[model samples]
Target: TMAGTGAGYDLSTTTFSPDGRVFQIEYAMKAVDNSGTCLGLVCKDGVLVAVEKFLLSKMLVEKTNKRIFPVSRHAGMASAGLVTDARQIVQRARDEARVHTENFGEKIAPHVLAERTAGFVHLFTLYGSVRPFGS
Candidate 1:
């Protein structure tokens, strides 16, 4: 699905079961105008969160900055709207996870990490009036 066009935000959920042995699910929420606000959840052995920022056609030509945030230790996060904000959130999540690991020494669960990421998104929404961008 294409989201963040001139159309309003779109939300969708998809599930995949491969050979009936493994179950995977993905949930996505996207904003209007391609301003690039969105969230994605990937569920495999665990859950991974991804966010993206919006990019203007002109900005795409410059190629000065690119999205590079790790969603989990084994995954990455990206978004389509407000690139700076999405980057900031990813950086903060990495720092927070590092600190938590240092203090807990690997006791943290994947679900907890997912929750933390969601909490950050929630806080951002509470403080700002921006939507997510994606498909």
Candidate 2:
């Protein structure tokens, strides 16, 4: 268990609890798990993304809702975590995809986009000031 707010073990991501658990990392993983599932598939035909809607409201219109988005003509994504954090990743993916097309004259691969997103997310874990993104 977390001993206290100022405990040495609780301060660094490299520190592990008595049970051999990194509390901060586990907490971040749990946050993502609490969100609904996001279905994504890549095949010879195209890329597809689906998200389970949770905050349905009578006054809210479907037209305003924009979860799944097209990164490019052939690629898009739907996320299941913090919307702001997810948007940060989505915007980065869009930038990468655009740069790929501009340089290589081909649409970016889904796996490449996923790898870049993962790499970006990795930073939060290693750095102290930046907290891990739940998305």
Reference-based lDDT, each prediction: 0.49, 0.75
What range of 10 consecutive residues in model 2 has the weakest lDDT sum?
A: 1-10
What does candidate 2's lDDT look like per residue over 52-73, in tens digits? Answer: 7775688877656566877788
User: What TM-score fits each model?
Assistant: 0.47, 0.75
Largest TM-score belongs to which candidate? 2
Off by over 4 Å in 2: 1-12, 41-48, 56-65
Q: What is the lDDT of residue 84 in candidate 1?
A: 68
Error of 1 at 135 (Å): 12
Q: Model 1, 1-135: lDDT tens per residue?
A: 432432222222122233331111111232223444445656776755543434456647655455546655754665554466667677767766787789988735657766787787665333224432221
